[model samples]
Target chain A: MASLIFQIVVDSLLLGGVYTLMAVGLSLAFGVTRIINFAHGDIVMYGAYAAFFAFVSLNIDPLLSLLFVAILGAIGGYLLFKLTLDRILDAPGINQVLLTFGLGLVLQNVAVILWTGDERSTTPSYAFDSWFLSDDIVVAKGRLIAFGLAVAFVVLLLAWLRWSELGRATRAVSQNRAAASLMGINVRAMYALSFGLSSSFGTATGAIMSFLLPITPFMGFPILVKAFAIIILGGLDSIVGTVIGAFLLATAETTIAYVVPQGIGWAEGVAFFLLVIVLIVRPTGILGTVGRDA
Target chain B: MNLSRTSVMVALSVFAAVISPAPSRAEDTIKIGAPLSLSGKFVSYGAAAKRGVEMAVDIYGGKVGNKKIEILFRDTQSDPQVAVNSFTQLLSEEKVNFLIGPIATPMAMAGLPAWRRTRALWVVPGATTPLLEEEAGKEPMLFHTFPYGYYYHLALARSLREKLGPGKTVAIIYSDDAYGREHLPYAQKYFTQEGFKIVAEELVRAGATDLNPVLAKIRRVKPDLLLGLVQTTDGIQLTKQVYVQRLNIPYLVGTAYPQLKQWQDASGEAQEGWVGVTTYIPGLKAKADPKYPKLFMDSDVWKAEFTKRYNREPEFIDVGAYVSTCMLLIAIENAGAVDDKEKVAEELKKLDVHTMIGRGHFEPSLGGTLNQAFADVVVHQRVKGADAILYPKEFETADKFEQATYAK
Candidate 1:
């Protein structure tokens, strides 16, 4: 029982790392742009496909090709924002939502046409490798690597936000768009830059997930739904809250699955239940300011 | 001037193509409606079935006697609602008496009401769950060409008992979807009847990314065998996660997925020693049907022909669809190439050909489906990137069951 508990804890933390990567970008984009980026999950899926193609075609490991994939994703996201979202910045929120949602559908269909909806994954040697911590407990190497990368990415993002000039300017825009504009800061440019960076993180998450999860066109929607829930739980605009929400959701799911009968099947429903409780208790979420204003 | 002319021509072509409906069938043509999931989740099944149907048509020379055969295919988009719409449109609008496909079980169930309205001579190439059988089994025109979920467990339990002996504990991990839920009771009944104690019966969300929670729980029980009842996608995830978790169970069993190339490719090292039940594996040697040599050729011969066209080895659905379509087309030919679905249905019931998947003949199923074919399935194991058939006493390739690679 102790070993099982330990295993559950280990699994929860690792899964939380994945969940954090899934939600952080959405939180970042929403903090600054306030657009919700309904297609964030599809952006992550594109990253996964990019990593997959790189791995299969060039024999590049997903981890190794992640840098290139992120850069490319940043460029693509920037272009997409400039072309579509940029034009609809002042449109009704419902219209913006529909556009991004439609964009996601288009991307998903294009992927299906290109890849034929077959389940695929990049098989690095470490994908099947594991470390036995004890007689009864084990840690998967691939997931451990994903957890490490996610931590590193989040830390780097936080540091950039805290210290970098461009990052500080972007945060200022997110904190007060009108004031930042009054201070002669390029608010639109910040939004564009933030969106690009968010997409970069999304793609990077996908590259890591190429080994951890099945690479399919439809894989994004679930990731998107979970990430949306976590961000809402953490506060839509709070990266810290998102991280906390991810871990909390993962722990709750893992514990329930280990302790209760038929728990994994109910885990997802329990996640929504948690979201409902959080919403009723704190409408602005644990740390969100946007929902309070709304 | 040339560029402008070329642009105008391109615009004209695109407009024409967009405006055109599928070429209308002539009065003398035999129209067959295929409502399949051509896009979205179940696209793999639909794509394979399309390939099979097309290949069968090509082999049949695109005509039955003096009449050209016309097939109208509607995409179901893998959604139940969409399947209903597709079936309704095909049956009501097209009004073709003959119908085929919409392969996955959920899609088939979705089309049930629409199908009953028209009562066309429906041929279902796939739908492993007994849901369809229970609902439409008594219908005279409905022909099920795949084995029900119970048959899979019946074969699996009987074969495992023969190899591992009685009293071995079993752990079954089933999905929460209809496929898993429907197969669970049958799995329980059959495995228990075979003298195995089911130590753990865990339910998982169909497309869950992480199965470690279930794995952690199952690890404690430490059953002798782990049976995963999931579709191909989940099967890959379970197989990979099971390997990573290093569950020490000696044997791993799956329903229908271990034989799939996609599962095999995605599973990598985790595929070994996993037992699966299927109607078609690449290596089941079968003889050609004597009367219809061209249509129902030998297994290897037909496989080579299919591979040559599709540029990949055939999976179970591909062969199932191909065999089912071929038999239907042949029955039409045998019925003197008429549009009378009743005469065609009678000819189909009379078919007794030795084909790739097994005897292609309609008989009453054990589950009470009046017209069922391909009830015979093969139990096989994945060993060294190849399938080794086991069971049925006649087609047994290896002498004994092999332990999983990691366990060994």
Candidate 2:
């Protein structure tokens, strides 16, 4: 029983790593823009599809194609932000939400139109090849690699946000756009950068996911939901809260899954249960008190 | 000439056109409505069936037995209400004498009642519910060019029971909708008779993701086998969670209708040794029936023509719709009239149509009075990156049927 609990923790941590990668991108976009990008999940899905196309068409390895996918995603984010998001920056919350929601639908439909809504997954050589720690427990090599990359990306992102001039500018705009403008920060460029960086994060997650799972055009919807749950649990404005929230949800969900009779359904239900608990107990969420924006 | 007299003359002319025996242009053209999902989840299936129909049309030079066939495509969006609306447009507005389907089972079921009022000849390829046959019994025009869900799912149960002895625990995660509900009764009936314990039965909302919760339930059950009777997206997500959770159950099976390349890519190595049952496999029994395989596989007819016309590899659902359309052609030609829906439906019941899958013979059975076509299915398992037929002994080209032994 102790060993089983240990196993669940290990599994949840690894799974949480992937969740962290997926959730952080949404958090960054929402943190800076104060607009919930419903298109974030589909953006990740598009990244995976772009990588899958490259992998299938050119035989390029999925891992190696991350740079290309990220760049493409960044460019797409820039163009979409310029055309749609830039206009709605100061709009009401509901309008901003509707804009991104409609944009997500368009992106999903565009993928369907082009690829016919067919399921596509990268046929990576090492996808299922995993090392067994013991006779009963095995860890997939692809996921482990993905976890390493996710950690490294998160570390690099934190360093940039803390140390780099661009990161400081982004943080300033997110913290106080009017004040940042008075202090000579190009708030417009900062919003673009934040959105672009978030896209890069989304692309990275997609690149990892496509090699691990079959990606369809509609895959974005669930991922979008999870990101929302994580952002809410982590405190929408808190980056550190996002990371903590991802782990909390992953661990609780995974642990409950094993203990509960109907684990899978229970786990999914628990996300909302957690949301309610957080709202009632500590409305600001775990680690959300420091600099939470409305 | 007074205005009232002119109006009366125009009304008379319109009435005469409706009552006229002659077709608009030539005695040749036969119009069939194909209400299929051109968007959403079932798009690939719809697209593939469309390709198969296009091929059939070209091979017959767009004519069957002195009549030129015109296929009108209507998108269903994989929604039941949308399908009903599409069928209404096809039947009442466009006035197609014959109808092909919306691919998914529920959409087909919902759209079925519309056909009753119009009394049009409707042939469905991908929607494979036994309930359809029952529904058709009340209104006999509904014809299916697909296998019943019970028959196909039974093959999976039989294979599993024989391959893995008795007393084993089986976990199932299925969609809590019509598609899953249709097959679950039959699965439960057979699996229980076979002496396997259903340890866990989890239901997922249609189009829901985050299969981790469901996976957690299955893992807790500690079943020897995990079975998924889910749609493509949920199936894919479940398979990933299984692999990620490292649940090493002996047999992991999925409902493998409308074979998508997504399963193989998504499940990857985890999909290895995964057992599934499907109705159509291009060249599986080609050696025994060389002509059947030759017509479906070796001929670049569909590939060349589809690429030339639509620029894509025809999906399985598209092929289904295409076959349904071709069957409509055979019926209309045999009936020898463009306007008679009942007569066309009667002719369709009598006709034996050969499709990409195999020979289809519609015979009146348990489901209804008019014979609904059923596809002969083979139990297939993935072995070393390729799908190999395992059951019925006749189609076994693989080395052996290896039973999955539980590891403690």
Candidate 3:
């Protein structure tokens, strides 16, 4: 019984790692640009396919292909912002939402046309390999690797935000756009950089996920919903809150799934349910400060 | 005044000529309307059905008797309303006397009213809901080539009883939509009657990616067999997760497992010994029958051509589409006239023909419904990266069912 509980906890933590990776970028985009970036998951889809093609056509290893995918994602995100978001920066909230939603539809349709609706997956040699801690407890190699990378990326990003010039400028713009503009920070450039960096995070997450999950043009919408739920639960602009929200959501889902009879169907609803509860109890989220820019 | 009168006379004469009946040509073509879900969630099946119909047309030399077959295709978008609208348009606007497909069960069900209203000879290729067959009882024009979902489960249940003996416990994990919801009860009914204990039954949302929660629950129960009445995506996901999480059950079986390439790509090496119930088994070496060798050879040639054209192995939906279309052509030929709808329906009722999948005949024993085609349901197991028939003693190509092992 103890072993079973331990297994569930380990599984939840691993799942939390994936959710953190998927949500952090979404949180960052919303934090800096306030665009919501509805197509963030589609960008992940593009990254996954890019990594897929690289592996299949170019015979590049998936890990090495992450670099190429991240670069592509950064460029694509920058161009997308310039083409779509730049024009509507000062538009109403509804307009921003609609624009991003429309862009997501376009990206999804284009992916379908290019790749067809067939589900694709990549299986490296160690995809299914695991390390056994005991007779009943095991750690999957793919999840462990993905978790390590996600943490590394998050730490690096936080460090950059603290120390790097561009990152600090981005934070300043996110905190107070008018003051940052008056203070000689390139607000537009910061917006573009934040969007690009956020997108690269999403793409890198997809590259890691490609080793674990099946890839399809339609796969993004579900993940997108979960990412939104996580950001909302964690606070829209708090990075630490987003990470906490991910683990909380994962734990709730896994635990509820374990307790209820035939509860798998309800497991997916746990995230949204948490979102509602979080909103009702604390509108500012766990770590959020009231009246902040984001 | 005389010139004006002459011009008026000429204009009146031209008007009269335009209003007159046109002369009939030497040969008239038969227009078959196909309302397919060619561009939505069901697009893969829709595309396969389209290819199948086209291939069947090619095989028939694009004609039946003295009439050249002309197919007018409409996309249903996997929407039932779209299916009905397309069917209505095909009947009223295109003036087609025959029809094929809507690809999915809900679309097929929704299009049934159109079938009754139009009374066009409708041959459904892919939808397998038994409810459609029940609803089809009132319409003589409606027919389905694919066996109902319940039939597949019943066959699997019988095979399980015979091959593995009785009293085994089974757990079912199915999608929570029309296809899975409707079939789950039937599976439970049949499996229970065959002496298998119903340990657990679970439903998951369609297109769900996270199945670990459900897998964990099932692992605790430790049923003898896991019956997955899920979509291709869900089935692949379940199998992969089952292997990765080491959820040990004696057997894991479901639909769409015969799609070897898809299963391999999705599940990797975990696909070995994965069993699936299917009507069409690609590359199955059949017993010698004087009438079937040519048909078998032709099917092989068609498969090769299909692979060459599509750059992928043909799915059972593709074969169902092809067979349904071929049956329609044969009925048209047997009717002796392209425009004779009543004669064509009569001919379809009398159809007892062999095609790519197997011998297809509408048995009258099934509630006197002459629309349901009876075909052999073979149990196929993934053996060494390819699916091999393993049940019904007669169709057993592999000597025995090998036990599946996962990495420890």
Candidate 4:
């Protein structure tokens, strides 16, 4: 029983790391622009496809190609923001939501047309390798790598936000757009940069997931739902809160799955249940401020 | 006065022309409605079915005795509501006398009310779940060409028991979807009947990323065999995860996925020694119907023809669709190129020919479906990137069952 509990803890932590990667980008984008990029998961799907093509066609490992994919994703995200989200920044929230939602649907359908609904994966050696902690405990190397990358991503993101000139400017814009504009910071440029950085994180996460999950055109929406739940639970604009929310949801799901009979089947509902509880207790979320301070 | 007389003469001529039949421009034809999921989650199945149907028509020369066969293709979008609209459009508005396709079980179930309204001679090439059978199996017009889920378990339990001996223990990991929940009871009933003790039954969420928790639990019990009841996507995940975890179970069984090239390709080296049940594989030896040699040629020749046209190898759904469409066309032709569906159904019932995926014949299924075809499932294993047939004795390719390579 003790060993099983240990395994569950280890599994939940790893799962939490994966979940964090899924949501932190959404958190970042919402932190600055306050408009949800519904196509965030589709961007991740495209990254997975990009990594997959590099692996299959050019024999590039996803680990190696992730850097290039992230760069490309940043440029794409910048262009996307300039084209669509930038125009709707001042529009009604529902209009922004519909625009992003429609954009997501378009991307998904285009993927289906380009690549038929076939399931694929990148088969790096690590993807199929594992380490045995004991007779009863086994850790999958693919998931461990994902967990490691998640930690590195968060650390780098937080560091940039704390120290970098561009990052500080973006944070100032997120905190008070009107004040930041008055202080000579280009508020729109900062929003664009933040959104681009968020996209980079999303694509990087996709590269990690290319091995861990089945790659399909339709693989995005379910992920997007989970990410949305995490940001809402953690605090929509709080990076740290997003991380906490991801871990909390993962822990609840993993514990329930391990302890309850046929619990894995019920894990999909955990996010909603957790959201309800969080909303009841703190409407703004665990660490969320109601106003514009991210 | 002369201009008015000319205008009256022209008006009378136009009226005569309008009243007369316009040289048969509508044309004599047979209309068939195909509600397939051409663009959504079930796109692969729908695309393959589309190919098979097209090939059957092309090979059959696109006509049956002077009537051009017209197929009205409707995309179900892989949504139940869309499928309902598709059936309504085809059955009610277009009023097609023949219907086919919508491969997934949920899509088929959603089309039931619309189907019941028209009662057209519907030929279904897929829908492995028994839900369709339980709903419309007794309908005289409903012809199911794919084997139900029970056939998979029936063949699997019998074959595995014989190979591993009667007392070997089994563990089942089923998905939480309709596919998994529906197949679980049958898996239990058959495996228990075969004298294998079921040690564990785990339920997994469909499309889940990590299957480690379930795998870890499964490892503790350490059964001899692990049976995964999942569709192609989940099957790929389970297969890869099981291989990664190296559970060391002597046998790993899957339902309806191991034979899929997409699954096999995605699974990579992890596919070795996994047993699965299917109605057709590429190498199965079958002769064409002696009467319709051009349409129902031998299996290998037909496969080569399909590859030449589609530029890819065909999956089970592709083959099943082709065979089903061919049989329906033949029945239509045999019914003397008429619009009488009752006659075509009767002719379909009378069909008994040697063709691919077993005899082109219809009989009652074990699950109480009145007209089921391709119920004989071929139990096969993946060894060194090739399939080795194991069931039905006559089509056996390998003498003995092989354990998973990593396990060995």
C-alpha TM-score for every candidate: 0.96, 0.86, 0.90, 0.96
* Model 1: residues with Cα > 4 Å off, grouped in runs: B1-25
Candidate 4 lDDT tens digits, A1-294: 999999999899999999999999999999999899899999999999999999999999999999999999899999999998899888899999999999999999999999999988898988888898988788888889999999999999999999999989988988888999999999989988998999998898889889888899998898899999999888888999999999999988888788888888777686579889998888888877654232
The CAPRI category of model 4 is medium
Query: Cα lDDT for residue A135, model 3?
Result: 60
lDDT of 4 by residue, B31-147 (tens): 889999999999999999999998998888899888888888999999999999999999999888889897999999999999999899999999998999888999999999998
Backbone atom clashes (below 3 Å) for every candidate: 0, 20, 0, 0
| lDDT for each residue of candidate 3 in A254-285, tens digit (9 for 90 to 100) | 77776677666787787578778888898877
lDDT tens per residue, model 2, A28-140: 98888877899999999988988888888998888999998898888888888888889987878899899999999999999998877767778676775556676445566
In candidate 4 the C-alpha lDDT for residue B9 amounts to: 95
Screening candidate 3 with a backbone cut-off below 3 angstroms (N, C-alpha, C), the clashing residue pairs are: none
Alpha-carbon runs more than 4 Å astray in model 2: A133-136, A281-284, A287-294, B1-29, B64-67, B129-137, B159-178, B194-226, B237-252, B257-259, B286-319, B353-356, B364-370, B403-408
Q: List model 1 lDDT by residue over B337-369, tens digit each.
A: 998889999999999988888898999998999
Docking quality tier of candidate 3? acceptable
Q: Where is model 4 chain B poorest over a 10-residue stretch in terms of lDDT? A: B21-30
Q: Which is better, 2 or 4, measured by DockQ?
A: 4
Give the residue spans of candidate 3 off by over 4 A: A134-136, A288-294, B1-27, B113-116, B286-297, B364-369
Candidate 4: regions farther than 4 A off: A291-294, B1-27
- The lDDT values for all models are 0.91, 0.73, 0.78, 0.90
Better of 3 and 4 by DockQ: 4
Q: Which ten residues in a row have the lowest lDDT in candidate 2 chain A?
A: A285-294
lDDT of 2 by residue, B86-183 (tens): 98898899887777766677777778778777777777776766667666654567677777777766777777777676798888777866777777
